[model samples]
Target: MTDTAHALAASHTLWELVGRRAELTPDRPVLLQGDRRLTFGELRGRAERVAAGLYGMGVRPGTVVAWQLPTRIETALLSFALARLGAVQSPVIPFYRHREVGFALRASRAEFFAVPGVWRGFDHTEMARALGAKGVFEAYDDLPDGDPSVLPAPPADGTAVRWVYWTSGTTSDPKGVLHTDRSLIAGGSCLAHALRLSADDVGSMAFPYAHIAGPDYTVMLLLYGFPAVLFEHFALPAALDEYRRHGVTVAGGSTAFYSMFLAEQRRRPGAKVIPTLRLLAGGGAPKPPELYHRVVREMGVQLTHGYGMTEVPMITMGSPDDTAENLATTEGRPPEGMRIRIVDGEVRLRGEAVCQGYLDPAQTAQAFDEEGFLRTGDLGRLTDSGHLVLTGRLKDVIIRKGENISAREIEDLLHRHPAVGDAAVIGLPDAERGERVCAVVEQPPGAPALTLPAVTEYLRGEGLSVHKLPEQLEVVDALPRNETLRKVLKYRLRERFSA
Candidate 1:
């Protein structure tokens, strides 16, 4: 972190940081969408107006306000407005439907609900009404505006829990992850410092703003005084023009985003997909080492993957200065304040960036150890040089005949095959082996079909242990993925192929 950013990081709250950044670079652009651009000065001034507007609607400090809005500039404004008021805000992913939305609203006990009314052919306002949401209001393109003079003093305590983020909930109901302004600022500071980004670099947010990454990525921009283009609805080829128009220098949301860009580059081999794109960086799901090499070799950009989740939005991140071996095989290193402890192969963390806890006290008790480190449930080891090497999830480990096997190990090897585009390895119910290894794969376009024998042979050739070899193979046209960061839904695969 630079001396300026280090000074800015000392700000007590998000609103304080916003005020500081605006003072430093008031005229600099902070957000860009389509033809609209918001400067640091505008962000601060407009957010205060919006805060006063919410105050008029009975929203005060600590009020639980839930919003299910898209990735629009307005969404960021409203969120910052709430921050200025010190109101507890719960942001719902725009793609979530009735079940997920209702769960978040009820779990947070939201007093006011914000929606985009009707977005992309869905009636969110109507659904909010059906769910009996309190204080339902629309906050899409038009926001409530009032005199900044009427607003209360900005929040001073950054440690107060003011944000509630939701888990992806691929297999079950989403859990509301509690976070404070300082925690979010810490998370974003770590990321910005790790990536070594500067004000000259332009970033892009292709994921949903409701995702924890919204604050994670936003803080990076605020700290560096750079602008990121917001994609309300992001899709490849369709969203390519905006990236080009804004000259996006850093672009990526996760491993899936890297694949999307790589596929686009393959369509036109020699030409750069986005001429201004210089780096691909993100982390939410597992990143195969082979994917990193292919991205560097084919797309001609530095690919830096990280490790994070809703509980800790920025854990470890690969740096451009790191060695290729470390970049390809490890998930970078944690920042100075972040501590990584491995207990029984589980990666536990303790840091200011880590979320306070879940909404439920029981869940919070179960998530942490007596030492106060948050149990990540991920299996990983710290390298001699401090880089994190995640092997697999504790739940993802397949036990066969009383022997433990890492599905990630098999999946990583499978990705090396020319025919395999993506793969998800799961354990299936088998009376013989207790649990059988199942390889579910999606073949790249124009690749040959793969069978069980062929997959097993490939694994054998890669020197995989006999016990870890997949017993069955299932090929599909496309892998099921969550809409936000495009993480593969492995639980869905288990349910689909178990029978």
Candidate 2:
């Protein structure tokens, strides 16, 4: 074997993998968490029913069936069901305050929205009533209420819209990321290969199934012929309990989730949790490097991170044969057939697995290069070893009088401070330099107070440019995050600075 390559395990189509593997291991447990269990055969049965139901309800190829539901078996099955019938599925967080929900619904022109009659003790119906009053009404329901005998047939041609993933708006308001069943199924297979999924591993899912990672994990596991443990909530205790009790072997979620998981584990020492958990993974944020080492020692799991956005998500990830740096630092090589490049520090991808374009044609035109690479907005480079490395981000860099400073670097340095619990660095308005760096922080318990002068003094010790250092550092209790819990909200930080 070459010194590189991580060695190819070869790639397969998303549905091809799932359908083939379902046939291979039909009786194996495909989905389970707590008391719930569905063998591959059983799960496929439910998926068939969901496909039939969606088909029966006028969901068709190119139709966007918006899902506003929970992370339960029904939701996951419904997703696959729509995929089975060539229906493009668009799911937004069900609890998004009325404005955000209305915006996404209208933006996607969503025809069918499967919302709970009640969710998290609030009335989604009430929210629906409000939006309905605005001359905008979508087909809304509480949840699925059908049985397995009502299975539907798969679509004939493969051109149907598979999924329309919404961008997290780290830099701008959310936009629709469009992918086909062909592309999404490809994504599933690509992620499975990156993670080295095996039938022996019981996958643990915590991210919302609506997002790329969660649904991708669910489908990848089923398609890979492996058991998948589903969690409806991101509760750390429940997650650990699932690990210890149910023998979950792999996990993927956001950095916030892993941070909270570690915190909860520390709260209960000597708990033999996730004993079989060989891999602990994160995406969405570049947390401190210490997080990897901590997970290795405390949780008995190998910590890995990846590079993806809601747009061209899951193209790069750490592989099974990766070294420590390869695992924790760079996002692994572009998945199977994926193509990527870094021009002017902006990362862009072009491949079949990549999304076709955003729902808006103008936005799509703005996001891609002339030759058609999906501009990923992240700042990264490919390593000599063929791995993809994200340094900072193009949109997140702060420029002051032609001196470009990385907000990630400042955030990383701030996190190194013992008293700092969490920090978010952003660029706000500036009269001369075009933009100025601002540091918003949440302090650790009993942590010493951090002021602007102290932050400047610390950066000065590092010999950073005075202007490059944050002009302002405000201590706060929380920072806003989208469904993925990313902290690159330059918009809010800008308003805060202006006010």
Candidate 3:
């Protein structure tokens, strides 16, 4: 580990890190949004005031406060304020409606709920009230403020659980993943050290601040003493001006983000999309190797993808100095303290960055193995060089004619096709075959229509096994994706094609 990584890992709490960074570079910008900039000094000072306000409102250390707000400067401020008070904060994604939000509030037993109030045309305040959320208050634009002198002493212990983040809830109710200050710091340290970023590089937060990546990215900025532009709503071409205006050098949310940038670049073949963007990096969803190549070759930027989830914000990340082949084919390597074990072809993790456990004791018990390694349901193997190559999720395996096939393997190949813009391979129920491999794809704009025979022939040319060839092909205008990180929801694909 580098000296910086070691020091960041040793941070006692988020507030302590913020204070140390503020002292080091009081005037350095930490967060930015069109015409508004928050320096490290102001971040600490304002958060202290907000902490005092919440303290006066009966908030105490370990108080569970739930907030459902969009990605904005105010949201970041409120979150840091909660950290200053050592309050256990549960951040629900702003897009989550009654069912998910209600579930999170009840499961966390939150004493207070913060909403953005009619953000993006949704009345989150009304929804919170309808759910009978306690201590409901609007936290958009205006936030709580009071005298910091009245606040209690900041938290000294970093190991106490202070965060509750939810899983994507693909098939069932979202599980509240527990986290501590130290764990979040460790996760951020790994990301900061792996990306090889410097204080000079201006970054951008294109994803939801409510996601676990919120803290993961913030820790990077605090450690590196840099600033990141916060995007309340990110869409290509429309967001290009902001990226250029802020001179964002590092930008990316996930694979979907990479595709968006690539599409914009293709729209204007020779023009540089964002002249200052030198690197594209993210880690929420899978990165098809072909997409990596497209971004590098077409967009003319170094693309570094990582592997992470709600359970762990950052597991492995491709460094700038890594080889092009490794960067494209693998999920880079884990940082100093992260331990990755491949048990029965499943990826298991054990380290400071790993979450404490799920809120439900039963779910927690089933999550870890005997050695305390968190059993990640995703399947992957470590390369000879220590990089991770994820094959597919255990549930993503398709059984056709009693033979197992990996959907990721097929999807990766499909992404290489000239006409294929994005692809999702699903296994739909079939009476004769039990389950059949189906390839759903989105073609590039102005490209010729794709046919099933062309897709199979291309897969065959790529050395795919006959049995693994997709039995069905469905082309769509776009794949169904979740709002956060724009991860393609495979469950929705199955639902659309099952019948």
lDDT of 1 at 319: 97
Q: Note the residue pairs that clash in candidate 2.
A: 14-185, 18-223
Candidate 3, residue 87: Cα displacement in angstroms equals 0.7
Give stretches of model 2 more than 4 Å off. Answer: 1-18, 133-153, 169-173, 268-273, 432-434, 460-467, 486-488
Clash counts for the predictions, in order: 0, 2, 0
lDDT of 1 by residue, 1-499 (tens): 7889888887889999999999999999999999999999999999999999999999999999999999999999999999999999999999999999999999999999999999999999999999999999999989998898988788899999999999977668888899999999999999998999999999999999999999999998888899999999999899999999999999999999999999999998998999999999999999999999999999999999999999999999999999999999999999989999999999999999999999999999999999999999999999999999999999999999999999999999999999999999999989889999999999998898898998898889999999899988999999999999999888999899888
CA lDDT, candidate 2, residue 308: 66
C-alpha lDDT score of every prediction, in listed order: 0.95, 0.69, 0.93
Greater-lDDT candidate between 1 and 2: 1
Total colliding residue pairs, candidate 2 = 2
Models sorted by lDDT, best on top:
1, 3, 2
- Give one digit per residue, the lDDT tens place, for model 3 in 1-499: 4476467568899999999889989999999999999999999999999999899889999899999998988898899999999999999999999999999999999999999999988899999999999999999999999999998889989999999999877778999999999889988988888888888999999988999999999999999889999999987788889999999999998999898888889888988989999999998888999899889999999999898888888899999899999999999999888999999999999999999999999999999999999999999999999999999999999999899999999999999998998999999999999999999999987889999999999999999999999989999999999999999999999999999
User: Per-residue alpha-carbon lDDT of model 2 for 215-321, expressed as tens digits?
Assistant: 56665665566777777666656567676677877776767766676666567678635567788765777756656666667876777777666775577777777
Which whole-number lDDT from 0 to 100 does residue 3 have in model 2? 16
- lDDT score for residue 349 of model 1: 97
Top candidate by lDDT? 1
